[model samples]
Target: MGELAVRIEGLTHRYPEQNADQRALDAVDIRVRAGIITGLAGPDGAGKTTLMRIMAGLLKPTMGEVEVVGLAPIRDANALHLKVGYMPQKFGLYEDLTVMENLVLYADLRGVVGRERTDQFERLLDFTDLHRFTGRLAGKLSGGMKQKLGLACTLVGKPELLLLDEPGVGVDPISRRDLWGMVQSLAEGGMAVVWATAYLDEAERCDSLCLMSDGHVIFSGEPAEQIERMRGRCVHVRDISGNRRHFLRRALGSAQVVDGVIQGDNVRLVLKEGVERLDRALLAKEPDATVEPVEPRLEDAFIDLVGGGPDGRSVLAETTPEVRIGEGVDRKAVISARELTRRFGDFTATDQVSFDVREGEIFGLLGPNGAGKSTTFRMMCGLLRPTSGDAHVMGIDLKRSAGRARQKLGYMAQKFSLYSNLSVEQNLKFFSGIYGLKGQAQDRKIAQMAESFDLGRYARVTAGELPLGFKQRLALACALMHEPPLLFLDEPTSGVDPVTRREFWMHINALVDKGVTVMVTTHFMDEAEYCDRIGLIYRGRMIAAGPPDELKKQAADADTPDPTFEEAFIELIHRDDEARRKTEAAA
Candidate 1:
């Protein structure tokens, strides 16, 4: 094999306050080939970031040696900085600096002075597609654009090794695709890239994979190889009983199945030892039920390796909804929008978007970047004043009674920001006080939330110091402290590990069951299924609004093509493109 770009031997790291042997990374060993994207996948607290920091020379391993670019990260950080680009999970970019200004600052920091600055800045902006918005403040860019800028700044000195920690988290769909495209292009040009992400779908796209959990590599190889490991074990079973979900989950809880998740009206069961009797009973209960074997995916493998914990029961069954478009919307929606539009000078962010989020149901708002979904979401949340049209949260008009609307709504922003200097508990207290909660009531709420999110121990830790996944949970907890009637989650699970995302959704679904309305925007297509209704936004308009299956059916049209939501999205975009082309031709 060619000389390894990254080599770690007996790597172990732990905090002093942690248990003596509570190692974040346990005696781990790994070697990364140059010029390939190696994805690091694991759940919250699994030590993905710790390993990345070690590789980047930011953190000192408790024990072991790391050779990055033929030198140790600790002893050679200055020298290594010239050859390595490290983007931490949270790369705090200066919000006040314009995109171009931030890029120039980085270039200058890397010693790109005078005549060379112009060309380098232009090239970086062009590659990152930030050229058009060079004047936009770095803080003002969308989640995806900020990420791209972060990557661009990291590339200032032409680093040979690039370590990206969950780079695509919280980005929109099209923007995520664009970021991946850029990453692959960089890899093709001979840059060794280490991308850490919780999304297994994204991990499958990596050149190779290193599955890390508990700070250890459980599996490392092509994703296909990992899939092959669990071949013929995963089966998709349609559960006819409405109670099938509860039953399957309880059964799976006792380890009566290999693994199980709700997948669109079916229980995907992994047959394991001791679950034979239960499996037989399930088959007998639903004789006509379809149980076809499925090819294993990375997600299945992750669940398997992670071991079905108590939270496994909380794992979302990827169930296809039974209701048609608007059929199951019984409760009057808590939030409604009608032809909402927002503009900045000459740029129209949202044209005319209308949708309703049913009370006590999970609703999804999905779209590509620049499609005005965020604008629509902001209007609903009363964060921005709509230029025209009307929006309401629990019957309170957004423009007329923003404070009243805010009282009924809890919003988890795309970017998780709590007071960096404040401890987790302190941050929760601040949010509680904002909602006018006091003393015993606030203490009770914080205790319950801490237990649910498992944030009890970290209550004293600084909010900024929490891991990416925990940061998300803490932000979510802060949003839910008031227990509003409705919640607006903007890409809450974006860039989170599958396990962590699963855990996050579990609490959300639980609250919904207790009559909480949810409006969520996410790039993960699979997540769209969890919604009772979904609205597809494009070009500042609601192009399609319906349940997931109905939208898929409509996108399929009379041809009866086998089109998934993703396929439907592509077809819709294509149709839009064609319509524009025809209009231009007519003109």
Candidate 2:
């Protein structure tokens, strides 16, 4: 460690209307060293954002001391601003400005000029891989591209300390890797980095990890140490019994099972301490069910430490319906894209993309930033007219009868698109009305949704005032108010905690079980396992499409019999990139 970059002691914060128990942050002590990355990991409402805001001088702590770069945050906020770079969860980049223009404006605002400014611009553009899209409007860029641009703007002056709040929340894995690489390089050059994230895997990369819960730091130290603490306590149960969900539900109810999650075809469980023996008698009831001790992951340890018993069970409104695959090539398609293509001037957003989503299927569109997934989604949802080609939803032509097609489908945009000024209940009512719900029907639907999504507490709260997790739930509720048979979810779980994500998926599974067809786009590779089929889009084309297990096998070789979904996704993208490079070289 070079030097102490940040120091906090007895840090506590509370909102004005909050009750005595509702402190955003409790008495917390933390020290961040220069030239290292400190990760803040926690569930929703854990106060990670609160601490970051206080460090950035955007908010004042009710009690406690905060020192950033040896300057008191409250007393020397103006000076502190000069030596620190803070990127909030939602980075404020002007939508109309081009990528280069945004960088220049931020540089000007930060007083970066001369040769240093020129060098920094080149470095940022290169590091973020945004050099190719310098002239593209910020609004025209994909979600991941916008994140990179935001990061580039924040790096204008190369401040000694960087505070990044969920910087990779909605970013693709490749872009996330690039962003992390850039941050690590910055830290190696003696800058202190504090990263708050919902992704536990990202926390494992940090030099130090701080796990927070209920506004308190329950654990803080090396990530490896945390994992070590849960060693021998984690176990993997192979479900040869053919009823994984039932087994999971039963296991969760048992006192021995701490937490259980579906991982591929098996159930990974964290058992309570001192329950070392596998219950053979219990296994005898379910033929061929076997349990084996396994290495604990960061998520397993976090869940165990936080005592998240049967966490997210409330989101499981009902049992998921069985997904039937390989019916036939002649099966009727719920969503179909035939030679879909869209272009803007010289740039092609999507090109000749053709795919079919079967009825009652959970279809996933996977890709990196700027790979045209959103453009394709918009075309299918009837939000945008494809420059050529055709799209159909529920057998209705999107190009010829978009209105009729839209009526049969529910669509959720990547960002929170509900009315910010309206209360949660009001927003739900508005959406219900838009979907043609009336009088008692709309009222009943709204009440049901409020309960289903656990939004009853925030019914009267403004949509903008709710937390990110609640906002996500409200947006989903709004989309589903009319109970459309087909649904489109774009980055639905982005920036949400693991528990919230699990809850969201449970709801999706329940809806799918009721014969609702779903089309979703996401950057999180793990989510692909839940989908019946996934299409990998890259550079304006559909490069690959298959079941998650088949896709993983395609990316694997003899040496790697079972490759992770993430590894498969990256491999496919890389292979496509290499092939494109070869074609360009030949040209």
Candidate 3:
């Protein structure tokens, strides 16, 4: 390895105000070398942030040895400040300031004055591809743009070591690839980087990784080596029970199966060790079903270590009534947005965008950050009225009877919109109460939700204190408490671990099987497989709309015979950009 950038031994940290038994980070040890990307990956509240803060000298540890670039973080705090750049989980970008102003302020704070400051500003602006949006306020910038700006601000003085915490959260795959390019280039230039993320793909790209769980470094090695641990236990499974979803649910419930995830028409299964046979026992009665052995991924390994996620069957699905299918069910359009247009001042957020979500199917609305997907979603949910055009829910006019129409729907916001001070049970009770449930029925619903989501243990705890995965479960439970026929999920799996995402989608799949209609928006491209049809929105326009296989087939050509969903998305966006360039040139 190259020269050591950070070295830790027997490090332990516990917040003074927190319970002494609850150690944020247990005895941990890890090393980071210069000129390589060292990924720190773990589930929510896995002590990644605590370790980063300790390395940054921002927080003093309760015990143990810590050294950054051969100097102690606390003892050489002043000197360490110039040698390291730390971007916390929530980057402290001044939301009101323009991109240029924020860059300048960060540079000034870093003491990069005079000609050096001006030169650095131009360099970072170009590096982040934010030169054109220099005048845009940080608050107004898209999620991807905000992440790039945060990286730029962190790179103000070119510190030897760069520490970033979840820098790619909420960013689309294309933008994430761009950010990876930037970080990889920096690493190649001999800058050591410690990136903390929940994304397994990101962890796989790292030169080496430190997989933490419960504040302990469970694994510290290359990604491939970690994946190799689960080599004999992985396989790709196909549906044999006629319905893929049903077969998958059966497979998950199988004793031999450990983890199962939907990956574009196929479910990848993580089988138990020594279970090489894929007979009728594992195939749910279809002995002839095709089962292909495949390479395991870092995600499978991560899920294994974190303890397998929730099983395939949903507890809530048992009691939740299905949306009754009538003779016209197949022809029914549960959610119809016709020429939906929403404008703010002189700027149009969604430009005559339209799509129809059929009954009992998952319709995905995908777009780059700030591409007006949220705007369209809010308008459809009756939270925001469109300037022109309109939406209909269950054939009811959203513009006119939004409240009455909304009664037939359930919504789970992207941010897990729960009262910070309310307990898990309390939040469930409150939402159910407002949705018209009362007395014993309300109480029964709350108990069911708590049990279904496996949140009974945290029922008394404040919602704010729950982990990211638990919070997601709680939010979903609250939404389904009403048992509405239609569900609206906004980035329901953003920033969650892979296992958690599967757990969530499993619940969703069960609901869909029960004839419920789902309209979801997510940044996770792999999730496109779960959608019956997807609408690709870019620059406030509906660019493409089709099933996942159709979209991928459309993007296929000479160089790539079968492009992945993400490649299809990028290719479509690239073509649109090229066309725009041509138009501008012609003008």
Top lDDT model? 3
Which stretches in model 2 have alpha-carbon errors above 4 Å? 239-250, 277-286, 289-292, 309-332, 558-561
**lDDT (Cα, tens digit) per residue for candidate 1, span 1-587:** 23489988888899887898688999888878777888888776778888988888889889998999888899998888888999987796889999988887888778877877777787888899888999999888878899999999999878899999888777766677889999989888888889988888788889888888877889888888877777777787764565444545454555466566554445666765333334556566566676778777888777777775344433111221222223343357568888888999999999888777776778898888667888789889999999999998776788999987788778999877589899999999999999999989889888877877788889999988887788998998899777676889998887777767767766666566556778999988777766767888877877777877677777797664757566677677778778879999999
Candidate 1 scores a C-alpha RMSD against the true structure in Å of 4.6
TM-score of model 2 relative to the true fold? 0.92
Collision pairs in model 3: none
Could you tell me every candidate's TM-score relative to the true structure? 0.87, 0.92, 0.95
Give the poorly placed runs of model 1, Cα more than 4 Å off: 92-95, 112-126, 134-136, 239-254, 258-280, 283-289, 309-330, 433-442, 555-564
> Candidate 3 — which residues are off by over 4 angstroms?
17-21, 239-241, 284-288, 325-331, 583-587
Question: After aligning candidate 3 to the native by TM-score, how far in Å is the CA of 391 from where it should be?
Answer: 1.1
**lDDT (10s digit) by residue, model 2, range 1-587:** 87999999999999999998789999999989989999999998999999999999889899998989989887898888889999999899999999999999998988999998899999988888899999989998877788888888988898889999999988899888878998999899998999999998899899998999889999989999988888898888885566555566666767777777766567777888888865665466687777888888888888877776544353424422343333342346879999999998999999999999988788999899889999999999999999999898766789899998888778889977899999998999899999889999888888888888889999899999999899999999888876777889999998888777867876776677667889999987887777878999999999999888788889997866778789889989998999999999999
Q: Residue-wise lDDT of candidate 3 within 1-587, one digit each (tens)? A: 67999999999999875687888888999999999999999988789989999999999999999999989999999999888999886799999999999988988888999989889888898899999999999999988899999999999998999999989888998899999999999999999999999999999999999998878889999999979989988887764546678777888888888888766667778887678755566564666568888888898898888777667888778889867644543346878988999999999999999989998899999988988999999988989998989798887788999998888889999877799799998899889988999999998998998888789888889998888789988888888888998999999988887877887888899999998999999998888888989999998999999988889988898998888788999998898999999999999
Question: Would you list the C-alpha lDDT of every candidate in the order shown?
Answer: 0.78, 0.85, 0.88
Candidate 1 local Cα displacement, residue 177, angstroms: 2.2
